[model samples]
Target: MSSAAAAVSAKPANSRSRVLLASLVGTTIEFYDFYVYATAAVLVFPHLFFPTGNETTALLSSFAVFGAAMVARPLGAVFFGHLGDRMGRKTTLVAALLTMGIATFLIGLLPTYAVAGWLAPALLVILRLAQGFALGGEWSGAALVATENAPQGKRALFGTFPQLGAPIGFIIANGLFLIIAALLPSDDPSRPSLAFLDWGWRIPFLFSAVMVIIGLWVRLNLVESNAFEKTVKTGQVRKVPLVTAFQNNFRELVLGTFYMLATYVLFYLMTTFSLSYGRAAIDAAVPGLGYDYTTFVLMMIIGVVFFGIFTLVSGPWADRFGRRKTLIWVTLAIALFGLCWVPMLAEGLVGVMAWLIIGFTLMGLTFGPMGALLPELFPANVRYTGSGISYNVSSILGAALAPFVAVALWSAGDGSPFWVGVYLTAMAVITLIALLLGRETRDIDIEE
Candidate 1:
């Protein structure tokens, strides 16, 4: 090959690595903020933001606030997806990181219900919406950045890099909270009160400032995505990417959204519901060894490490087996695992460990393929809008209602957690069917 041709090819490969790195770091921080709020919703928000109710009611209210973020996600997706397609990917990603960072940092400063009454929960909901909107833009932009810049024949593998950010972010968020909880003095008769509510809970939210600065610096250095650049050169950028996406890619959007159901439902079941179940079981004198709240946090961190490893593994497997095939098998596995929830949870600490390890492994496999699968289903022109809308909409349907539904089911069942397992299993079955019906896009030429 001529030197000019060789140099041209080399440039994009080098740029792709940088793009992947930038997207990975920024996405990790964004999700760190997002998951930090989720963890707080379970452990702290019920006490701090909605302190007026009984335990169950306060927990339900906390999850309701959590759902508010999911509700705003689709709106954020539509707004940012338009800008990303028309203006550029780099610009949208940078803006998303800043929006999430500022909102999360400010959450640390908000007054409790004791000080602000109804206004405290009201303000929390508004900030939660801002966080949701920022995250709505985050995934699609990061996925496009990785996929667009990837080397030929390796898009699936490269695409998983950004997906890796989710578990890493989860670990960082949960790990920080666990550390803080550990440092506080126990409230048992033998120990002094550590005053967790007075100060400890705020530390994790406050630390978001450090991550935000680092994420912004990395994102600012990234160049616009090559797919978007090609759109500009060809004068094919959509004036209303969301409209165009709906007009041309509605079928794929529906399928992608449903295909994500199992993952989202399983996500909340494993993370949020497990925390509540573990704590309640411990307090109720269940037969098996019980875990304190902090123990559950530590278990989740362990699950995240496995989550990252499986995500890495799934990318190469998807490239070899095709996205649809890989996803179908993973979805089926999740459905089957959901059935084991009650039995496992009943077994105490050992059962919980087994449950998390198995559940998170499946989560990794399915999540890895999704980064490539959803975007590849659409043509490059509307990829940002199509993938962004489908993803965030799925978050609303699957994740937003998960905690609320699980709690209601548990209550109606007279403290039986088996009903929660059935709910998650149903979502997995839907995802399995959706994956079976979807096309395999692993070999589709990206520029098409």
Candidate 2:
């Protein structure tokens, strides 16, 4: 190639690399900040915040608070989506980083129930809502930044770059928790490590400041997405992206919401619900595996390692095979995997390990292509708004209630995991139907 041609090509290629890097870094922090709460909810919040309840009640209440974030995610979607579609992905994402950073760091500084009583949980709810709001705009912008800047025919591969942040975030958050959990010592008949609950947990939330600073540095260096730039150049940027998305892109919006359901439901069931199930005291009023916290969390981290690897692999497969086809098949695998939940968890730690590996592998396969598929469903003018709405709406429909619902389902089944498995399979089927009926996004011109 001529020097001039190579230079021009190299510019976009380099920009795409930066977009992917920024997306990975920013989303890693976003999810790390977010999942730190999920981890804490299971590990400490019940004991620290809701001291008034039985173990069952305390765990349920913490999950209730955890789920509350999903309630506000759609609102964040609207607010940030508007800013993203109106202003630009870069500015909106940077703002999201700052908002999440400030909120999460504040969470570390909050007093526990012993010091502040009911006020502690109340403040936690407020901060969790803020995290939801920040994430509302973060995912769409990151996905669009990566996918829109992607080279032709490789949108799925590029899109998965941002999705990789999920597993990476999971690893970091869980690894830190595990390390800190180890420092505090385990509960024993003679002496217990109340330190983990007393103050050790706060260390994770407090550390979010560092993650935010790093994320902001990377995001600040990023340019606006090429798709948004072209929309601006064409003078076709919508005056009201949210409204335009609803009016013009309703079908794709709906399809994208259902398309995400399988991923969200399976994710929480694997990560959050399983933690509760595994860590419960077997002889307690409510039955659980009674595993140690650090061990179970370490297992979860190992499973997430596989989750991270498959996320990268799914990108290339989605690019080659098409998003709809990949989703339908991988979701079927999820359904099959769901049916094995009872048998696997029944196997003790080994079974639990098997279940998580299978569940997370399937989660990666279904989740990876979303960054490309969601954005491709909308026009550039409202892509942020449409994808944000659909993605967070799915959160409400899927994850917001998953742990709470799974617990309820487990209770309703008389302590069996059967009903939860049915629920997962049902969600996968719904997602499969959504994919079959939705647009074949792989061939869609992103520039459209």
The model with the greatest TM-score is 2
RMSD of 2: 4.0
**CA lDDT of each candidate?**
0.82, 0.85
lDDT of 1 by residue, 1-448 (tens): 2442333334343376587788799889988998899988877788788876577888899999899899999898898889888777778988888899889988999998889999999999999999999999999889988887777767788888888988999999988887877787566521113476777878888999999888888877776655665676666877888888888889999998998889888888777777776666434422113456776678878987898999999988998888888888888888888788889867766888888888889888988888888889888888888888888999999889998898888777767777888888899999988888888898787776
Q: For candidate 2, give the lDDT.
A: 0.85
**What TM-score do all the candidates reach, one by one?**
0.94, 0.95
Which TM-score value belongs to model 1?
A: 0.94
Collision count for each candidate, in order: 0, 0
lDDT of 2 by residue, 334-393 (tens): 888878888888887688888888888888898899999999999988988899999999
- Misplaced by over 4 Å in model 1 are 1-14, 188-194, 281-289
